[model samples]
Target: MTTPPFDPPSEADIATVSAQLGRPARNVLGIAARCVCGAPTVVATAPRLDDGTPFPTLYYLSHPAATAAMSDLEATQVMPVLQDLLATDETVRDAYRLAHETYLADREGIAVVPEIEGISAGGMPVRVKCLHALAAHSLAAGPGVNPIGDLALAQGDWSPLVCQCVDYNKDRASAGQ
Candidate 1:
């Protein structure tokens, strides 16, 4: 597999990702996607977390604005429509399946966990469960890999190209590292 399309996270990147998540960022292998302003938008997490829990979601959405936008789409019931499209459109289904395989390959390239074998995030290759995860995957992998992620992002009110970051440093809340 090609190298995971991400850079190893810096100290500041990890801290900012922690702040954006409102909790300590855990087991982040790399900065998957960043806001144009340089804050972490998505993080590449280890398949097995520090606590040894199996994490199927390799790309975790961290930016508050991006997450909020995806939440808005979910609130508006976009998942069912996307799910319907997956069911009816063979081309979409095929692309989604390829996306699942790609996700699995990427994650397994890092480290394999028997529990999450063949499983990918956001109900990929089958359903549309979490727009946050799907969008994160899209942002991390870039366009054309995940059609559902691309569609969710297109249907949402956010863009990675734009900067909508809040002053995370001002916040005092943290779930502890």
Candidate 2:
């Protein structure tokens, strides 16, 4: 809490993240995690945006491959299965609840937003809404923090150890963005 537990993002990082997300990176406080190829994977965003918006997704998945993998899992309806696991497994539920608490603590360590005080992203401690958010947290905070996130990353076909980034700049240049 004394110092943020992540690398401060540079201008090139912002540019690369923008390209990864196919839009401008908004209020990214730092790079939470990086791929093996040194590309941004998880981005740490501000608890609040410049426009007074309460943004709760602190650790955001920026890598296209990672996002696509999470999307694929959602498309395959894996949320229900994970939700059931959360409902049935007491240990996992307890860990998930703890993860939610830690997430709130981490965010509040920066600044407390009354509007999003108890709310954690990815339907944490209750539901399995977004695998991307959960996976991002796991990737950033490392293993054993978020149970659902660990499970999701285990089930997903993507690997952070390998870089799956495509040159979005080249794609945009060829298509004239």
Best by TM-score: 2
Q: Which 10 consecutive positions of candidate 1 have the poorest summed lDDT?
A: 168-177
| Most accurate candidate by lDDT | 2
Candidate 2 residue lDDT tens string, 59-152:
9999988888999989998899999999999999999999999888888888888999899899987999999999999998899999999999
Q: Per-residue lDDT of 12-105 in model 1, one digit per residue for the tens?
A: 9998888778688899999988899888899999999888899999999998878889999999987889999999999999999999999999
Can you give the lDDT of residue 131 in candidate 2?
99
TM-score of 1: 0.92
**Every candidate's lDDT:** 0.88, 0.90
Q: Against the true structure, what is every candidate's RMSD?
A: 3.3, 2.0
Q: What count of clashes does model 2 give? A: 0
Q: How many residue pairs collide in each prediction? A: 0, 0
Q: Give the C-alpha lDDT of model 1.
A: 0.88
